[model samples]
Target chain A: MQINSSMKKSFLFKSLVDYLYILNVGGFLLLLTTISFGFVEINVIKGGDEHWSLLAISISCISVLTCIVFLRGVYYLRKMARHLLTHKYFSKQIIKCLKISGTHFLLAGVMFVVIMILGWIGKLREGLFEFVYDINLMVPLFLMIIGLFFMIQSEALLVAKNFKEENELTV
Target chain B: MPIIINLDVMLAKRKIRSKELSERIGITTSNLSILKSGKAKAIRFSTLEAICKALECQPKDILEYRDS
Candidate 1:
């Protein structure tokens, strides 16, 4: 009974899931505001230039899409965390959630990289490309690594599930 | 799958209910049911001993081999 309670309230996963939820909402709102600002700049202000408006709109559109994909990943992570909280360490739902989360994260990472590349190319064409390195490059790279890790963890958990079943059946 | 547990038979012979036997052997009713239903992968010697003592029977009386 004590174990069940502790498992049900595992603070680490609970906190992590909560943090992810905040991040998801914040990211979505930020992207929406950016898109709104882009439109306002283009339509409301006659003095505003076209290039920044267009760039902002395009970037925000792409970001909104990526955020949606990333939201899916976060959703699965929350589901997975719920299962973990219930002490269901080796179940089909967890494996499926992990797999889905991994795919979404991988897709989001790839899309983000593409967006950055396109932006970089646009700047280069405009002769505005900077030579300095951008730390923002690490975000997508880390996301991809996390996706791969989740995939690998799911596979590892698959094998562990078999062992767990075998152990459970042992009288 | 080939190894069968005949704990139900022994329980019947001993006129003991599953809940009673589980209590006597200090195991959960679900685990006892698993043993009786032949779903258990393996039985520990200690559990076998406890069951044997509770039912006043040998391990052979509680376990059997089947071709299927």
Candidate 2:
């Protein structure tokens, strides 16, 4: 059958969604490798007759959990893109995915802040605060802002979806 | 929702089958079914005109308003 304009649009979206899925998978693999290597380094430090502190274990656990949440957000983004490709742009599934991803981003921002505060305290205890610039703290703040933006975008999508539904039903 | 479509009643009174009426009105059988089943959110004036002409009826004969 001959392809129409809408089918062509869906095809383009499908390609973009595939690219995003590849990038998400690559990033997730890199993150896992980094976490594994970091754990090895921590183990080496503990092997030098020093016990692993409770704080250190807690930080590692929190880091892994936060990463998982962030990855889940990426997964939702991929799902949303796939839904768009399938011409389900104004669906409940898309809205739910957006909201879930937004919430994950917000949670990741909070986790980043907590981790940064812990790092800052550790630096202060070692008299390293003098060398730490305010610029170093900007990342978490930026993430928080981005998270808020995602949340707002999700809300906007929800409203647009509602309007589209109403329009469709009006016919 | 209170504006009920009496399309099926009119069709019955006119002794017309849905498929024949839909064909005469240049609409699909499914669209006619939607109108008959009261599932259509809104009907176009052109479609209403076509339906009225095909059924040889007035607008009020095919539509009724009742308080919910």
Candidate 3:
């Protein structure tokens, strides 16, 4: 009983679910504001003699979509943390949340890569290939790696859940 | 699947109620019910011994094997 109480208290004290939920909401509001500002700025710039290129518009669209997907991954992660706080470590809902979060991360990474490739091609067309470096490509690669890691972790959790069920049913 | 619990039969034969048997064996009625229903995946030797002792029966009398 003492151990159970301590465990409950520890989860309550250590869980970042609430904080992440707040951050997700705040980040979403910030993203919305930023996108709105970008649209206004784009219109203002278009009113002048300089018009936005198709590549620039495509890049903005991809960037916004990637940010949305990343935010969704954060939301799912928050859900997983909430489940952990409830002592549901091996639940199906938690596993599904993890899987969804990982998929979102992967999708965000793919979108980021597409944006980067478009940017690179745009630069190459302007004869600026020498400025393109591997350092600029690291962030999307990292996101992909992190996404794969989470997917593998979710599979491990599924196996652990199966074992826990078997143990419980063994009386 | 072949292993079966005959706890209910022994309890009936000995005229021992499940609640009384559970109290004497220091186990919950739900757990005893699980045993009786043959839904328990495994039983500890201590629990089996306690059950046998409370029911006044041998292990063989409380358990049976049937070719399923």
Question: What would the TM-score be for candidate 1 when compared with the true structure?
Answer: 0.66
**Candidate 3 chain A lDDT trough over 10 residues, lowest sum:** A40-49
Q: Is the docking of candidate 3 incorrect, acceptable, medium or high quality?
A: acceptable
- A33-107, model 2: which lDDT tens digit per residue? 887787534552122537665566666777777777777776787787778666666688887887787788788
In candidate 1, position A143 carries an lDDT of 88
What tens digits encode model 1's per-residue C-alpha lDDT throughout B1-68? 88888888888898999999999889999898888888888899999999999999999998888998
Which residue runs of candidate 2 sit more than 4 Å off their true CA positions? Answer: A1-39, A43-49, A52-54, A125-142, B56-60, B65-68
Which window of ten consecutive residues has the lowest lDDT sum in model 2 chain A?
A40-49
Error of 1 at B9 (Å): 3.2
Evaluate all candidate structures by whole-model CA lDDT and list the values in order: 0.83, 0.75, 0.80
Instruction: Give the Å error, residue A26, model 1.
Output: 4.1
Where does candidate 2 chain B have its weakest 10-residue lDDT segment?
B31-40
Scored against the native two-chain complex, candidate 3 gets a DockQ of 0.42
Of the two candidates 1 and 2, the one with more favorable TM-score, higher being better, is 2
lDDT of 1 by residue, A1-171 (tens): 988667757768768887988887886787579866875333411324545556556766787788889998998988888787767778989998998899899999998998887677656766785654687888899889999889988988999998888889877
All DockQ scores: 0.64, 0.40, 0.42
